[model samples]
Target: MNAVNDDPNGDGPHHDGPHHDDLRYVYAVCRPLAAPLAADLTGVGGVPPRQLTHAGLVALVGPVPERDFAEEPLRAHLEDLDWLSETARAHQRVIDALTSVTCPLPLRLATVFRDDSGVRAMLEDGAERFHRVLERIDGRVEWGVKVHMESEESAAPRAPADAPRPSGPGSGRDYLRRRRSQRTAQEESWQRAEAFARELHETLSQRADDSRLHAPQNTELSRAPGRNVLNAAYLVTRADSEEFVELVDRTKDEDQGTSRLRVELTGPWAAYSFTGDEKDRAE
Candidate 1:
């Protein structure tokens, strides 16, 4: 959905095209921050972010130019990988700052508005879910866990690395037997890897307050060493971070049956995956 200027307060026809006036770029929502933000912190467009309060919640916003951030221009800019990467980095930096200070409900990337009035409207509209989600995530952090199985070619067991390939099928009967045996072994290894992933996710879920099973990331995109078997997020209390991390680390065993398991863990971050209500986030 387009996150363009939605001036609900009859603020004239929505300002179209590039204009001199600046739009508000929202980063996150949270209860009133107790500590002050770092003086040097900057958000998208290199603009300093400030808080705007409404309905007992604070929204972190910064000014962005309409020429670049307006609906038509913004959609075009999104296609530029360099632009998207820089914007994402800036966005995450702001969210990270908020995470350090309080339990922030992070908005999706490019959440923009015409002005403070539009932002306030959003806050009032989703006030109920925002409060409910805030209460649920307060003082809690998210952790990520992933499991991968090393490529079969790299983890060969039956043949030695230095073995020479046969110039031809030395014996058709023997070649067929060897091929069948290799296929069987590979199938068994894959099955074992899948079972290992399930067991580990269950174990981690038992320790976390809430868990989300995210779709496995693409190998090409993630550059993961092997097939991504599991990708999950867990919500645990701040106090339980140490134990949760330790639990996750203990299961990163390389020797789990014939399947070489590669376990990955990330976080102690804001609950990015937990409070993803698409309807509310579309704002």
Candidate 2:
């Protein structure tokens, strides 16, 4: 991603040196805010984010050193786990703060430009798409819901203490029977999980403006207690958030002790999943 600048002070963000120029990083875009943001909010590179308005839209940006953000250097930085994590966290901090005040169209991390002109050009190029997105997602947020089912081993029943420890031949037969029973139970659990996920998504969709189904999460990466059966996002209005939350709560209660299934709800995030593909954002 390229980066931007429009420094008021001669010594601040954008550098107009003969050999080097600092870059501007865009965080998100939205309408002119009704009120100014909190004074202390900061973003990537530890710089405070400022609004740059063009064509009646606001692009939230901040400056970063060209030495670190310019093309070659940024590619190297992206490979550094610690650097990427820290930068991503700072980027998210600004977006989170914005979500509290407005429905912002968040750009991907590392959306940069060479100068304020470049940033404005991008806004000009993407205005129509941006406007459509803004109209679709205005006054709304994204909610994530994931359903996980406990492993069969965890849900399997234990043998009764009073049951006999059978002779060798009988013990082997009993073991085989148990294995077959476990397999049957596992199959049943998977089917039940699928059914529950579909039902839940359908119910939630009626209350949401839009819905997206994501691939189930990897158990190894998520480190959750069980396998994910449903991974979905819902675009819901702020006014209906409470009722949506209550609906989830009711489902949670209904799910209690049923195959040890669990429903996890996340966010009131900026309509990240609902935004259509935005071109010219990071190019």
Candidate 3:
């Protein structure tokens, strides 16, 4: 794969001035220039944000002291969970700002180009691919739906005392048996929840231009505060987004599950989750 180079001196224009160390590149794909860049957006190491455009797409960039994102420091930083989280959040802030006014293809974390020429080269060489992606997402936006099973204690049916108990050697064995039972019950609950999620997705997909299944995140993601079960995104036509929401609302009412399973729908966001460099991925 042709990855963006983060090395400041690699192949981009040389900057020997004081601000030379303050520049870094940020990524976005096939977005209209009119889209708003985040007011507070800064580059990799707090460099002031700037824009780089080629063809019909635009990217937000900034200058960073080369030492701040030096290869060695970057490698170590990438491994730090806190660093990763903060970077991801900043990237999202930029994406969110652009998404408000234009359909943008969001790049994953750490996509950096050396300079304007590099960005232009990528866009020029990948023009056809970019064009295709823009065509597919021209009038569309992405919406997310998640399904989750509430705590087992909240959803599981209480077993009667008469229910057969595992004849165990000690309380430990009984405890183990109960844990196993809970695990099985939780799995069953998730299965049912997933089924309803799929049905709802199918129904909405009919009205969407495209749909995709996103990889599941760990329970830690729940700390972000939302009932995201099936982490699915849809590429909906701009005109139909409101209708889609109404349809989802209706589905939620019709498929109400045991207190355990819950559904949520979010976004009319720029097709960030959907649009991307066609040469990189068809979607």
Q: Candidate 2 local accuracy as lDDT? A: 0.83
What digit string (tens of lDDT, one per residue) describes model 2 on residues 1-283?
4222233121235422222476879999898776556666778867778777788778888878898888999999999999999999999999988888889999999999997788899898999988889988999999999999999777768889999777876889898998898788788878888999999999999999999899999999889889999999999999999999999989988844556789999998988887774453445
lDDT score, residue 257, model 2?
50
Q: How many backbone clashes does candidate 1 have?
A: 0
For candidate 1, the 10 contiguous residues with the lowest summed lDDT are 1-10
Instruction: Give the Cα error of residue 255 in candidate 1, in Å.
Output: 2.9
lDDT of 3 by residue, 186-277 (tens): 67777777778788778888989888888865667566332456778899988999999898777667645553656678887767666654
Off by over 4 Å in 3: 1-18, 35-48, 154-188, 220-229, 254-259, 276-283
In candidate 1 the C-alpha lDDT for residue 255 amounts to 64
Candidate 1 on 57-127: residue-level lDDT in tens? 88888888888899999999999999999999999999988888789999999999998889999999988
The per-residue C-alpha lDDT of model 1 at residue 69 equals 90
Which candidate would rank higher by TM-score, 1 or 3?
1
User: How many clashes (backbone N, Cα, C below 3 Å) per candidate?
Assistant: 0, 8, 12
Off by over 4 Å in 2: 1-20, 156-167, 256-258, 277-283
In order, the Cα lDDT scores of the candidates are 0.83, 0.83, 0.66
